[model samples]
Target: MSELRDTELSAKVKGIEVTVTFPLAHGKPFHAKQAPETTVGTVRSEAMSQFGIQEEANSTYYLTHGGSRVDDGATLASIAGESEAVKFTLVKELVQG
Candidate 1:
C-alpha cells in the first residue's frame, strides 16, 4: 500500500495501514488500519493472532521494518512517517547463549 492520497480512513484518525508477513508462517500478510498512536506491540499481538501463532517455549516474535528490528514501543505513525502504509516482516528469534 502507498500513501492515502486523500483517501481518508476516518475523520478523527489519519489512519496508517500496516501489513505484516511471516516467511515461515505459511499464511498471507496481516493487514490493519492503525491509528497514529497505535503501538508496535499491539500490532504484533494482532499479527500473531491472525497467523494463529502460539507462544513457543524458547522463541520470541519480533517485527522488522526496512530490514531493521523495530522496538515494540514504537508507534506506527513513527514508522510510516509521512507515508500512510508500512510493511513489516515477523521474524522468529530463538534464544541463544
Candidate 2:
C-alpha cells in the first residue's frame, strides 16, 4: 500500500488551465511533475506495480505518446515538450517467439 505524494500540475489546454491525473496500475494516481526529465522506462516501471505485473514476467510494455511509440531512453519532455498535458497509452508488447 505505497502512497504517492500528490503533485499539482498546471497546463493550458486550448487556453484553459486543466489538471490531469495519471492513473497507475495499483489504483494510485500521480501527476507529471517530473515528466520533463522522466524517461518512458521510468514511468513504465512505476506503473508495473499498478497492473500487478512482475518485473520478471517476461513481458514488455510500451508507452505511446502523440500517436507514436516512445523509446525507453526518450524523456517525456522530448515527447510532450512544454505542453500542459500529455497523453500516454500503455500497450503490451506482443511476444514474437
- TM-score to native of every candidate shown: 0.83, 0.59
Model 2 TM-score, 2 decimals: 0.59
Cα lDDT computed for each candidate against the true fold: 0.82, 0.52
Give the per-residue lDDT digits (tens) of candidate 2, residues 1-97.
Answer: 0111111211222221112223444454433454455566877666555556665455567777655777878655555544645666666665656
Over 4 Å off, model 1: 1-13
CA RMSD per model (angstroms): 5.7, 9.8
RMSD value for candidate 2: 9.8
lDDT of 1: 0.82
